[model samples]
Target: MSTPLDIASLIDRERIRPFQWTIFLLCFATTLFDGFDTQAIAYTGPAIVAAFNLAPGDLAPILIAGTLGMTIGAMTLGLVGDRVGRRPALLGGVALFSIASLATAFASGTSQILVLRFIAGLGMGGCTPVLLALAAEYGPARHRGAIMTGVLLGLPAGAMLGGLLAARMMPVIGWEGVFVIGGAAPLALLVLLWFALPESLHFLVTRAGNDQHAVRHVLARIVTWPLADDARFAVHEAAARASVAALFREGNARNTVAIWAVYFFNWIAWFMFLSWLPTVLKASGLPAAQAPLGTVVVNAVFIVCAIPLSIALPRISTRRLLIALLALGIAIAIGLAYAETSWGLVFTLAGAAGLGIGGQQIALNYLVVGAYPTTLRATATGWAIGMGRVGAIAGSAVGGTFLNMGGPGGFYLTLAVPLAAALLAVIAIRTNEPEAGTSLATAAH
Candidate 1:
C-alpha cells in the first residue's frame, strides 16, 4: 500500500515548482495594483487641491478614509478567504477595487471622494493579507522568508511605477487620467487571474471534510510525480475550532497583540511619509515640479533595499534585523529634520528612510505570517494590518498638522517616537522558529 501523504510535510520538503511560483506571481500582480490604488491619491494631491480650491489640511479626510476602509476590510474580508478560499476572496477584492478606481475619476466633491476611496480601500486592504497568507502557505518552509518578501516587494514596485506613470501622464491627461489607468489595468488582470490562479492545496487539505481527491490533484501539479489515488492528506493543527476568537486563544493573544503593536507604530511614520512627502518636499524648497521626485526616490530605494534584505533574512535573526532597521530609521529621520534645499541631500535622506522604515515593515509581515498556524494565518495578518491602518489614518491626519505647524523638520522629529515604540514591540515578541531537529513531517503532526 502507498504511504499516506502528510500535505504540509510534502510541501515543506519539496523544492518550489513552477506552479507555486505562478501563484506568487499572481499575488504579486494583485499587490502591485493595490499599491497604485492606495498611493495614487497622494500622487494627485496637488492637482486635486487646486481643482477643489482646498487647503493642504483638507486632504486629510480623503487620506484617512482609504486606510480606515482598509482597517474594516482587513478585519472582515480577511476571514472570507478562510471561510471560502483564497482564490475567490482575492478575485473579489481585485474587482471591487478596480471598479472603485474607475468611479473615483468621476468623483465630484469631497463626499464622493471619501465614499469612493473607502470602497476602494475595502478591496485593496482585503487582498493584502490573503495574498500574504497564500504566498507563505505555498512557499517551502526553508525559504518562506524570501518568497513572502518577494510578494511584499510588489507594493513598492507598483508605487514606483505609478510615480513614473503619473509623472509622464499628468502633464498630458491630468490627475483623473491616472485613476482611469489605475482602474483599467487591474480589470484586464482579473480575467488572467480567473484562469491562471489555483486554489491553495494547504487550505483545501485543512478544510473540514475536505475533498481529498481535489487536494491530490493540486498536489500532482506541485510535486514531481503523480500520487496514488488512495493516498491520504493532512495539515497538522490542534483541533481547536477555527474562528477569529482562536486568534486570541492558546497563547496566541500575546503574539497577536505584539504583531498589531508593531504594525500600528511602524505604519504611523511610513504613511506620514507616503501621504505628505511630496508636499513637504515642495515646502522644503524643492521645486514644485520636482516634488514627486522625492516620493519616487524613496520608493525606488525601498524596492532596491527590500530584495537583498529579504534574501539575507534567512541567515540572520529576524527580530534583531528589524530592531536594527528601526534604529537606522530613527537616525535617518533626525538627518531629514536638518536636510535643506539641496535636492541631492533630500533624495539621499529619503532613500535612507526607505531602507530603514520600509524594510522593517516588510520584515514585520514575515514575522506575522510565521507566527500563526495555517488555520488563523489570514485572520492574524488581516487584524495586524487592520490595526496598522489605524496608525496610517493617524499618520495621514497628523501629516497635515505637521506641515501646518512645524514644517518638515518638526514632522521628521515626531517620527522618531513611533519608530522607537515599534522597535520596543519587536523586542517584546518572541521568535516562533521551528523547534530544532523537528522535521516538517513531525512538526505538522
Candidate 2:
C-alpha cells in the first residue's frame, strides 16, 4: 500500500517552468492540422464519389488501406521515435503525409487514390503517438493534463475546418483543390517546426549527454526548480534495456493486458458508432439530410468533454476513471437502441456516447503511458494504439455488414458485445503502485 511515487510533486504545473507555453501550443496546433487533413477526405466523400464515379461500397478499400497504413506508421515510427528522438519522427511523419496529400490531388483512379490515402494515413498515424510523447515530455508536469487538452482539442477544430472547407473551398477548387491544400499547407509548416520546436529537455538530458547549454536553457525556461546539479540522461540506452517481455516482468503484466483489453473494446464501440450511426438514423425514419447531423452533434459533445476530462483525470485514479468511462459507454450503447424518436433523445444518447468515447480515450492513453517507465513509453503506447486500430477497422468494416442485414437498432445493439468486453477488461485494471522493474507487456497484475 505504500509506494514511493512522488506523483503529486512530480506533476506540479506551477513548477513546470522549463518548457515554453508557446512550444506546447505549437505541438498542439500541429496535431490539430493533422487530424483535420486526415478527416478532410471524409468531408469530401460526396465530391470524390461524383468525380470518381464510385459506389458507396467501393470506397471501403480506400478507408481500410489508409487505416492500415496508419497502423504500420504508428508501430514503425513509434520505435524510431524511441531511438532517434521525437522531433525527427514528428517531422518525417508530417512530411510523408503532406506528400501523400499532394499526390491525392492527381489521383487518376480509385486504386491510386486509395494508395495515396493509405500513405497519408501512415503519416497521420506516425504523428499522433509521437506528438503525444512530445507533449508529455516537454510540457509542465502539473499542466500535462491541461496541455493534452490544448493539443488534442485541435482534432474537433480540425474536423470543423474540414467541414467548413468542404463547404466553401470544394466549390471553387473542387476535390482536387482540397487535396492540394491539405498536402501543401503542412509542407509549409514543416519548415516552422524544424526551426521553432526544440528537442524535449527530458529527451536531451537522457540521450544527448549533459549539453549544459541546451539542457540548462530548456530547464531554466521550462521547470520552476533550480537544481545545482545538471545531469544528462540517456533515454535511448534506457529504452534499449526494455524488452517486450519486460511488460510482464512484474505482477503488472495483468494490468497491462487489462488496459489493452479495455482500449480494444472502446475503439470498436466508438468507430462503429461513427461509421454507422448516421446511416442508421436515416434508415430509422430520420430524413437523409438530418442523418449526418447526428455525427456533428456527437462531435460537438466530444469537444465539450475534452476540457472536463482533462480537469478530472489527474484528480482521479487512472484505473477508476478508465472503468467508469467504459461502463458509461456500455450504457450509452443500450440507451441508443431505445431512444427512437424525433424528440432528440437519440441525439442525446449519441452525445453521451461521444462523451464516454472521448473520456475513455484520454484515460486509456494516460494510463498506458504513465503505467510504463520512460524506456518503453512509446512501445506501450504503440501497442495500445495498434490494438485500438484493430477495433476501429472492425467497427467501420463490420458495421456496414450489420446495416445490410438488420437496421440501426440491431446494428447498434450488436456492438454492445464488444462494449461488454471492454467493461470487463477495465474492471480488471486494479489500482497498484508503479514498480521500477515492471515490464508493461505482462497481464498477471
Could you report the Cα RMSD, in angstroms, for every candidate shown? 4.2, 6.2
lDDT of 2 by residue, 1-445 (tens): 2332222233344554434666777777777678767665565655665577764445566767777787788778877887777888899999999999889999888889888988998898888878876776665444565666678777766665655665556667887887888888889888889987777555565566645477656555655566355343233232244566777767669867977777777888777676556556656876543454566666677888877765665556767776677678777777777776743788788778777765677567667745765666666666777789998777666765675665667776777788789888877766553443332222111
lDDT of 1 by residue, 354-433 (tens): 88878876566557545777667656665776788788889988888877788878888888888999988888887665
Candidate 1 differs from the real structure by a C-alpha RMSD in angstroms, to one decimal, of 4.2
**In candidate 2, which residue ranges exceed 4 Å CA deviation?**
1-19, 46-55, 82-84, 167-177, 202-243, 246-257, 275-293, 317-324, 334-343, 366-382, 433-445
Worst lDDT window (10 residues) for model 2? 436-445
Structure candidate 1, residue pairs in collision: none
What is residue 147's positional error in candidate 1, in angstroms? 1.3
Best-performing candidate as measured by lDDT:
1
Tell me how many clashing residue pairs each candidate has.
0, 24
